[model samples]
Target: MAIEHEQLERSSLTRYVSPKGDFIGFRDEDHYKEKLKEWGLSSGKGAKKEFLFKERNYQRVVTIKGYETYGKSDEFNTLVIEFQDGNLCCIHPAFLKEMQASSFGKESMLQVEEKDFSIEEQASETQEQVEKPEPKLEAKPEPKKPKATKPKKEKEPKIELPADKVHFTASVKQFALTYNPFNEENDEVVVLENVVIVEEPPIELGLAWCSHSKTLKKFELQPGDKLEFDGKVAKKKLAKGKDVEEEFIVDAAVQYKVNNPSKIVKNG
Candidate 1:
């Protein structure tokens, strides 16, 4: 039988029988339909009946490709294989040659009707079971608060040292910048209360010692200036051959290394 190539449904990688070989290539179900339509009946020229050359999966009534079987064998059946380069293949069992020969007229296709054309079913193809899901929960937030503060302390006033508690005050009656006996440095020799009354007689308080005449000169006290000072009193300790060395009374604040600024208590 002669069939036009245009009449063939050219599905890629699907199984069919070609004139080149028996049980040979893969083409989709459409190709199978085309083959069946052509091989089932001859039309037009050379109207001789076409023989049943191959079977898909060696079954009759192969009206459609076995999708279940295809899934199991990675979309291919042993009967045929299709290649990317448009090559077709047949997987005829050499061991089953006698069996195939014995079943000669048993699986022949005179018409497109399904006879022994059942696509083989898988032995363990059971349907799958489905499952249900669970629900979810959310979280909540907390409140805000204020912070506490500390208290402060109070201050006290400072009391300076009283002059009476530290020294004696006297008026400068007369003064001279004289050599200091103790240190051999010049100091202010001043007369305090030029005349003092004791036992109703006038007594010369004579001379008293003061420190740092340069400081006193810078300050300038003429006849009377009330000065406050601390001093070592002249004592009566006899020397080896004399009653005592010549002594004076005032030992000024400067002698004690006091650095307080000089304040003129009065102007004479």
Candidate 2:
């Protein structure tokens, strides 16, 4: 017995709009990267199809090369993908690669119709009579001015930060937790506990230490308690023999928050 593969059509008979369309394929590598970016997947050069398909928002529809039929398993191939914003779809690796190798698909070959110029001529004649051309006037001409080009400002090189010096305060801004983490809990307890605004008062190294102690007492940070810090501070390394970089520390803390364990209550 011999095995035979189905022959794909040479031209596509179907049209597709983003999101609503039943088919999606990226001809341009950049477009494929954009789709991956939309899915929150990595768009790096090393990123691959298998990794992008893992995203939930990637979507695509497979068809028999140029055939109009879609979503029918018998007529078209399965295009595994995810759709987001109901606007764009991400094609699977197999489909994307195959489609890119294939021709521009059905987007080629625009339709053109023959037009009869007799109708246009009738309308033009019925409009009005042509007026005589106006006499040309010679006037004084002004000299051309020289064009000026503005110089572009060069971008500042990013500072090379040390390994340990990459402190949390170096972040552009403090991270925020907007979602209510304890909305579904049985009792209406505060999900976020003990928020402290450190790096305030006298700008001294001891200030952070004092605040750390206060935070430990107020929030009761256990072994695995989570804490967030936000602010900016310069990091300096000790130029010594052994504990040079490791011994260096900075002073900066804008805000901090923690999650508290549920409170226990006795039955009435």
Best by TM-score: 1
Q: How far is 34's C-alpha from truth in model 2 (Å)?
A: 9.2
Q: Score residue 231 of candidate 1 by CA lDDT.
A: 33
Top candidate when judged by lDDT against the true structure: 1
Per residue, candidate 1 scores C-alpha lDDT tens digits across 59-130 of: 221112111112211222233433333444443322112123446545443322343233222222322233
| Prediction RMSDs, each to the true structure | 58.5, 21.9
Q: Rate the local accuracy (lDDT) of all candidates.
A: 0.34, 0.30
Stretches of candidate 1 exceeding 4 Å from the true structure: 1-165, 180-188, 194-207, 229-264
Tally clashing residue pairs in candidate 1: 7
Could you tell me which residue pairs clash in candidate 1?
14-26, 14-27, 14-28, 15-26, 15-27, 60-117, 61-117
